[model samples]
Structure formats: structure tokens, C-alpha cells
Target: MKRGLLFPTTLLLLLLLGTIHAQPTPDPLDGGDYAQVYARAQAGGDAVTASRAAAAMTEYRAGGRDWTARAVQAARQATTTRPGDPDAQLALGSALGLQARAGGYTLGALNTAQQARAALDRALSLAPDRPDIQAVLAEWHAGAWAKAGIFSGGNQDRARTLATAAARRAPDTLFVQAHAGIALSLIHDSQARATLTRAATLNADTPLERDLQTQAKRVLEGLKP
Candidate 1:
């Protein structure tokens, strides 16, 4: 009786241990689900879906730079799959710009920034009337000007023109307003504070718009007197 009880107890313990050992570890990068969505969009040849997925991936700020890199990869794939799609090009440019900002002035970051500028220029050429693209391009030019100066070909005047154009094109879009605010702030324009304040108070229609609003608020808080 005792021997039989011991065998049963040992078997139960071994089974429990096996179950514990078989449990899967949680993924740290699980926040990158947008990559899978982008893959599906690619498989379906849906440029709109691909662009949305790329934008969604960029919104995953909790995942940090790794997540942003995934956004860049997804955006790049979208652009490659739909070379003529303005939205795809815009998504790529946005992701690259975010990555460049996060990485700062490293050589790799500078290279990525150049790629972002090219992508944004392509998007602007494809859809000259797109306010979001114009605003983003304005911010890009302003950022370049702030970082590298006019001798390096960065143009604050061009940034201001693009920002003004974007604001005129889409006065109601939070994305455009926020980016325009950023461009103006980079040049230390007096209107930056008012634009950023207005952008922060605007209603966000989508998750991306909400993120832009949040960014605007942060910039507003950081502005110097």
C-alpha cells in the first residue's frame, strides 16, 4: 500500500513540473502586433490597410525605439509594395522621421533623416494638396535646420512656407496643426505658442490624431519664455 502511494505521488509531482516547464514565456515585443497587420495588408495588396497599419505601429510608444523600428520596417514594406501610393510614402517618411528623432545625431540617425526627407518629398510630389504631408515635411525641414544649419542645406524659410501652406490646407486637422506648431517653434516664431496651444486643445478624431495632440501638448509645455 505504501509503495503504491509513493509511486502515484511521484508521478503527480513529475507531471506538475513538466507542466510548469512547458509554459511559454511572454514576449517583450508583443506590442508590435501592427507588424502582423501590415503583413496581412501586404499579402492583400491593400495600400490603405498597409498605411494604417504602419501608422498604428508608430503609435505604439510604450515599446520604445524597438517598436518604432518595427514601424519603419512596416512602412518601408508598404512603400515598396505600392510605389505610387502617396499614403505609403507618407507613412514611411513619418516612421523614418520618428526613428531619426529618437536616435538623435548619430551617423545612422542622420542617414535615416535623409531617407525620411526623400520619402516625404516623394509623398509631397505625389499629393501636393495633402496637408498632413506638407506639415510633416515642414517639421522635417525645421528639424534639419535646427540640427545642421543652413550651410548643410537645411532651410528654415522653406520650413516656414511649408508650415503655412499646411495650416492653410487643413485648418481643422490636429496632425497638421501640431506639426505646423512644431515647425514654427523650431524657428522660434512668436506664433508657435498660440499654434501649439490651439493644437493641444483640438479634438482628435483618431488614435494618430490623439498622439499628435499629446505631442503638441508636450511641446507647448517645453517651450521657453
Candidate 2:
């Protein structure tokens, strides 16, 4: 079977990546704005850059494209400044993937998608034992496959394997369980329901994690029938 990359699996991926061109969400932090958030993420420490860049993804999930690409560039600069920083790599990969999805299916978007995959892969390479990276990579592979199938180098089985491991290793981590839920569902795994339920029960500390939990709950609800 063409396990890894299939068109049918892309829908959940798009759901997680969020839509582009919608009205930007007001900054979640009480008195903050997109420009200020972007600036803070850019000028912050690499770890802060990664974390805030991730919050920017929540904006994408809310359908705002305004800051996603710029956040990605800031996250990318973190990777360049600290080539071995796994967190930086993950943030860059994720932002690029979201930014590409926001761009639609143009040629440039395709190339950006490829870059996202490369960064995600690099993150895994840098931290093979990290459940967080594994969880993200699992969804990335599945999403990539959905975008271009084997041409996109996505592997559902690979996604399943990584997600299973991530779920087992980091059961309480919202990002891990939520992303694993997505990876599992894309592959039509029976565990999707359980994983998403687990994710739904977890506490969310950031807007990103909150959106992730909301996504997991929606996916779980869809599976109830």
C-alpha cells in the first residue's frame, strides 16, 4: 500500500496547519498586537523565539496569514544562529509548513513545503529521542504525504510508528498527544480516538496548546460517528 503519502490524509493536516487569508486574531496577551508579538519573538532568546513563534501558529489556526510568514523568518534565523538547536529547527519547520499551507499550492509554496520537511527532518536528526520532536515529525510526514503522496515523501506507517512512540513517551504533553492524535487519525489508526481523548483532557499553557487541544477535540468529535 502507498502508506505514507495519500491525498485523503491531507484534510486533517490542513486543519492543523490552519487556513490562510482569514482575519488576524487579536494578540492573546492582553495589550499585545501582532507586530509587537512578532518583534518580541524575533528579538527574544532562541528558546523564547521558538516558543513565541509557535504561538504565532495559533494565529494561523485562527485563519490569520499576516504574521505567519514573518514569524517563520524569525524562527529560521534562530536555526541559522544556532544550527544545532532542535527547538529552533522544530519552530522553523512548523512555521514554514504552516506558512506554505497558507500560501496555497503555488510553485513557491511547494518549495516552501519542501523546506519545512527538511527542517522537521533536521529537528528529528538533532533530537532522535525527544518525544516532542517525534510527535511533530509524525504529523509532518503524514501531512507531507497527503500534500504530494510519495512525491512528497510522506509515510503513514512512519507517522504511525513515531506517533505511537511519542504518545507512549509523553502521554501528558499536550503537543505530543495532540499531534499524535492527528498523525494517527490520518492513517486511520484505531488509536486516534484514544489519543485525541487524552489530548482533550490535558491542560493547555499557551494559545498554541489551547488551539491544539481544540483541534484534537474537533477531530475526536468527527470520529464519534
The parts of candidate 1 lying over 4 Å away from their true place are 1-60, 205-207
TM-score of 2: 0.76
Instruction: Provide C-alpha RMSD values for all models, in order.
Output: 15.5, 17.3
Give the per-residue lDDT digits (tens) of candidate 1, residues 168-212. 777777778899999989988787888888799888755556666
Mind giving the per-residue lDDT tens digits that candidate 2 earns over 1-225? 565566557876776567553556643342334345555655665443544444454543452665575667667678878889887888888888787777776888888888988998999999999998898889888887767778777898899999999999999888799889988887778999999999999987666567667888888888844
Worst 10 residues of 2 by lDDT: 26-35
Give the lDDT of residue 18 in candidate 2.
75
- The segments of candidate 2 whose C-alpha lies over 4 angstroms from its true place after superposition are 1-37, 45-51, 54-63, 205-208
The true-versus-predicted C-alpha distance at residue 136 of model 2, in Å, is 0.9
lDDT for every model?
0.79, 0.76
